[model samples]
Target: MGAAFITPGEIIENSSNLTPGKGTIEHEGKIIAMVQGNVIIDSKSNTVSVKNDDEMPTPKVGDYLIGVVDRLGEKAATIKIIQIEGDGRSILPEHQYADIYVAGIVDRFLPAPVDAMRRRDLVRVKVTETNPVLKVNTRDDENCGVLSALCPQCGEDLYAKPEGDKNVHCPQCDYSGYRVLSNGFGQGYNLEKNGAAAYNRLKQRWSKEFDEIFKAGIPARSVLLRADHRFDGRKITRPNFEGSGGNNQRKERPKGTKLFVGGLARSIDTEKLKEIFSKHGDVIDAIVMTDKETGNSRGFGFVTYSGKASAEVAIKELHKFDLNGRKITVNNADDKSSSKREKKPSGKKIFVGGLDWNVNEKQLEKLFSKYCKVIEVSIPLNRDTGKSRGFGFVTASEDSADKAIKALDGFELNGRKIGVRESENKSKQKNNKNQRSTRELQARREEGIED
Candidate 1:
């Protein structure tokens, strides 16, 4: 019969009549192949076995190994075993990897494996177990530790510094840190001459400064911090004085016209805003404020004219003006703060709901104007459609507010019965003091710019 190709863990013989041979083991009275090869049944010897022509050497216990750190975790680190010490034979592909846990890093207590070695560090380790998985130890021998390593903060060579808090220090950046160092650490120090005494001179405990920094977290260093000094050919220069190169200072001119344009259509851009406002006066600057993300219009913008007369005319003619089939609001951009300082509006704000989409600020103002002198009327519109949100706010004298609420609470206007009441919101004048825009405007005024 032709020999059958067998693989590891494959049953070769089911009876005890055949004894297990090399590359095979007996389990439960069955002969199992331990390697991938052709099964040989020796009838004369009454034995079965499997054999492979090629087999790579694997490390045994108590053998020293040279490897590089591959991965680091909080509890353990993986090492890629390269060569078995004093053995030039290559390791089997399946056994090329090993691991060294935090407890195996040093005799002293370590918080993590990184405190001893980092990835890509060349290390010498002693094999501890090789059956289920390869395990190595760095603290077993003084010579079995990191032979070469780079600084964690700065990518420079680390020198052994037994005198400092850590075993290693970077000469360029003055960064000191610890490592499970070998006797032959840095520049290939002769272990025979060094006598492995330096390896045992580990600090008994972490210093107070190191403990604090470790608890606080590792500090990050950037290449830009040392770029200017490292590279002399391309040096970056900084401005010696404040407001240099026209960065911090705005161009000075007469207090020109600045108008706040609200209720702008979503499709409008800076060019469209400039085109529409040009008819009023020479448009020095026009902008349509947009969302930082999405780049869509914010339903409000600012416009600047060369002269204040042009601005006053725009506010008069364009307030509640219709453009793009939507009614808009126009007011002096600087008037909000100025009006509060000059004369605080004395009134109680009344909320009006169930407003028809057709209703506007003019209609609302006229309705409340009959009861008392209306201080201001605000009908917030949907930013997208530029349509009224079916509600508005009106400011009137306290006595007039009661009269208006009683009269207009259920009064039908343009087909909808409106709901009216004393606004629950506090005075906007007091709230404006805490607004971000108001704070920015106050800052700009404090920068020596006139209204």
Candidate 2:
């Protein structure tokens, strides 16, 4: 018989017999087709899979799975497998969960589960065992394992330590750890939303999801993760000639190697820009921004080098350096989050102290107004006399507050050399005063004994 037409929610296969496959979902002890397609049963695998008219990518046994390390357990890891290596798209029908046991991970003996993998490590594993539960093996794979891993202490991508037995070092911070490096290691981390979302899916294994795949039925290939794989680094400023090949290679551009070159002349071509940047380091690929249709320079381009260090050197040397009369800006293309985090703090609240008894809100506002926007001003007063207390406070923009303190403090305001600085909130102020008073009392006792 030809493949049978199937509709969503229609039970196509029984749980006791065939396993669920592509375009299928498991609910209430039955494998139901989730897509409108023809159901095809694989006799060898005894699994029912739905085949759409158009070729749809169905993950099969032995397929290479790529994802970030999620949770590490006693002997297994919760891997958030996002895509199969051969699958063109990194997307899935939904975020998938795959579990692997200690034995299924690698060939060599790992003393502890963590020795095999670390959190946030991007890994590649091949499905070795598949049944109701998917099993993967990262062990004994010379070419695959962890492609990108970070330093545990600093979260910076690691570099091949100056010299070691396969140890990786954090470039930003001095910390190193054991690693299971793939053919390509020390590539920068891709901290994008999708990548984060992939890991976050494992935060919970909801009852609805357990019934959907894990708890009562065959694990769907679309969201399968097999454990029992042995799991498992490093920066090297590798030279370019070895791998420098094509423009498309840049599309697979590694993290730190990519550079965003802005402020380009409309006349400048990709080759010219590449030549200009190549002096500082090896340029793997270069592309001048161009019109989608007309194919003309958009006055900005990207240049990628073989490694992060090389790209950094090029950026530092070329950033704002007059290039053919235009000072071009060069920076890491993937440093968007890092750039935002590095911005200086502004409008921070600061405390003001040591005000003269004569100081009033109006006077304080007038004094600090020259520095920054005066948001509010308060002067605590003596209730009986209704005059200014020994001290008061001034609240202003961070920049203005900083300026006010520097300019007016200790200026003999109203015959008193007033002090000014960041203010501790009232509770903290009381606590500090109490602590200081204790110290003063202890000092007085010691002085009396000496006398």
Task: Provide the TM-score for each candidate, comma-separated.
Answer: 0.39, 0.33
Which candidate leads the pack in TM-score?
A: 1
Q: Report clash pairs, candidate 1.
A: none
CA-RMSD of model 1: 18.2
- Count of backbone collisions within predicted model 1: 0
1-451: candidate 1 lDDT, tens digit per residue: 3387887888888866888877788888888877788888888888787767765466899988889898776678999998887777677655789988988988876777766777778888999999799999987578878888776555677787675457777787756667788877764535544633364455377778556544532211112223313422342222233232222223454367788898788877889988988998999988787764466777888889999899888888887787765567888888767543334467988899999999988899998888766988888777667778899989898777788888888999999899999887556757777645657779878997655
lDDT computed for candidate 1: 0.75
The lDDT values for all models are 0.75, 0.62
RMSD of 2: 23.6
